[model samples]
Target: MCRWLAYSGTPIRLDELLYQPRFSLIDQSMHSRYGVETTNGDGVGVGWYPADSPAEPALFRGVGPAWNDANLREIARSTTSPLFLAHIRASTGTAVQQTNCHPFRHESWLWVHNGSIREFAKLRRDLLLAVDPALFPTIEGSTDSEVMFHLALTFGLRDRPVAAVERMAGLIEAVARTHGVPAPLQMTIGTTDGDRVWGFRYSSEGHSRSLYYSTETAALQRLYPDNPQLHRLSEETRLVVSEPLGELPGAWQPVPESSYGVIQKGADELGHFEPAAP
Candidate 1:
């Protein structure tokens, strides 16, 4: 399992979430409170839509613990973006390398995950075969997360992200059943395409990992009228995280079990989620 956070709203320094909070993503890399593993130090990565060129997202990843990465810290303090995702990896059953780090990117989209595809070594071949041949070549790492991303792309992520992911899950579970893995998946995923952010919580079994989104900006402002940061953000400012960054009352809402939600410009959407036939 891993720890990740997706942020979309007003442009702000990456460290504001990656490091400033009491229980920040960087802090989670060393002392996570909710993840299955307390320390997610295998690797780290972040992808953000640059302020000058929001259409092009930039990635800064390293095969080192984020807690001690001077370069990552330096860049985080200097860069500001309207949307971004940062992840600290705790490899489930794969090699610890730069390519295997999360916040995986494809064109303008970025993705991160906090769970695993059980028995991935057994199902990897079948899952890989289902990816579009054109997109298969883009698969740079042997992570179930990376493979999952490309599978979503093959299923039409660019045009219908929610549906594509449902189809992707359907196929994985179908394949897992054939191989005798009763509970084949557990995941809390976050994804975005520069414009909108989507977060999902689901598993083959009913219980899934934790996923949360910040309360609406306007509401938070009313609750903490003295918090200057809250005052600076737009009503749409949002954050989707593997866990809450702090203990602020009513600041984070758990995404419903087996559900998905989107944080975009207009009113955000929350809906039941289930695997659809591939």
Candidate 2:
């Protein structure tokens, strides 16, 4: 299990979201209130698209707790981005290495997840074989999260993200069933291609992990009418996180179970998500 957040819209310093919030991702790393684990100390990663360079995101990651990383704090303070993804890892049977850290990237695309594939040891080989051979060499981590990213890529994530993810899930469940394992998939995932972000909440048993999106700007403006920062942000600004960054009333809305959302420059879109044939 892990914790992650994806931000889009206004360009803001990483610290404003990763550190300055009352319950920031860094705070969640040690005192997670919703994740399966209380401490996600295995590693941490941040991927951001510089305003001047949107085609590729710069990434910084390390094999240590995010709360204790001085460099992470410094980088957060200095960097600003309109779109970014950050993750804190709590190793789920995977090596605690930099490669296993998330916000994994490929060209302009980035992905992160906060759940695992049940009995992955038995299902790993079959899943790996399903990946496009060309992408197989890019598989650098043992974590199912990374494999799932590649699986979605192989299933055509670059073109049809929602359908690609559905197919990826369907393939995993199909393989697990053949191996006599039930309830094979569980995930709260986020992915982006520097333009739009997609988030999904699903599990084989229906009760997936927590995922929430920020309230619309109009609502936020009314909620914090006098807050200058809220006034400064664009109407399209949005944040999707595994848990609320703070306890601001009416600020976060839970992503419906078995649903996915698309966050972009205008009104967001929400749709029912289901696993389908690969």
Candidate 3:
């Protein structure tokens, strides 16, 4: 339903990942090779950790198309961070507005998702009521993606990300079953607390959206050998995206279906996951 990328490791300018690649996020906004829609012009958002407070992530989002957002270009040139999350949106039954755009923030964490809930209107009320009342005020958007964020928070995402996500999927399934909606929910979620970034790819029917992670920095350096741009990155750098950002063959590997991946400095791990029971 959308395209997104999460990056963690050595500090790098936003442009390095958003604009420089042949199939960059911005390029994907205009022409996606592996998404339901090629043009994700509904909105865009970026979240990053400042040099001073790595624990506090800042976000910039808008309802305008990314290709036409001048502010995005300016920020991409001027800002640099060790961890970042960006998304280009294609609306899935919600109003296209700033607050509805993603990379939703709460304290030290930021999150975004790339799919939709089946029959959202039928279950919105129940799902909303299930959220922690304390978190209700922070819920500014009306998208199922943001609702999914708060559900994870209710299940304790800040302290136990993996389990929190599992709980969230369970809640979604429960709501879907309550309404007897047969269509499956598809979710490819990315989240970061400024230190460790996590991405999950799953669906209720067992067929989820696309996701890919970059080859290990050491391996890429050896493969590229003479490419100065890639060589500039520290061995700890890594990126996970909804699709390959460029034509660099072998530079990206598809994340396995029904799995979640964690990315930290020099640490990249993938684990098989099961949908939370309804």
Predicted structure with the largest lDDT when compared to the true one: 2
In the range 173-256, model 2's lDDT, one tens digit per residue, is 999999999999999999999999999999998989999999998789988999898999999999999999998889999999
Question: In model 3, which runs have C-alpha deviations exceeding 4 angstroms?
Answer: none
Model 2 bad stretches (over 4 Å): none
- lDDT per model vs. reference: 0.93, 0.94, 0.90
Error of 2 at 14 (Å): 0.3
Estimated TM-score for each candidate: 0.99, 0.99, 0.97
Task: Please say which candidate is ahead in lDDT: 1 or 2.
Answer: 2
Residue 25 lDDT (model 2):
95
Q: Which regions of candidate 1 deviate over 4 angstroms? A: none
Q: Sort by lDDT, best first: what order?
A: 2, 1, 3
Local lDDT at 236 for model 2:
93
- Per-residue lDDT tens digits for candidate 1, residues 139-239, read 99989999999999999999999999999999999999899988898999999999999999999998999888999999999999999989999998999
Model with the higher lDDT, candidate 2 or 3? 2
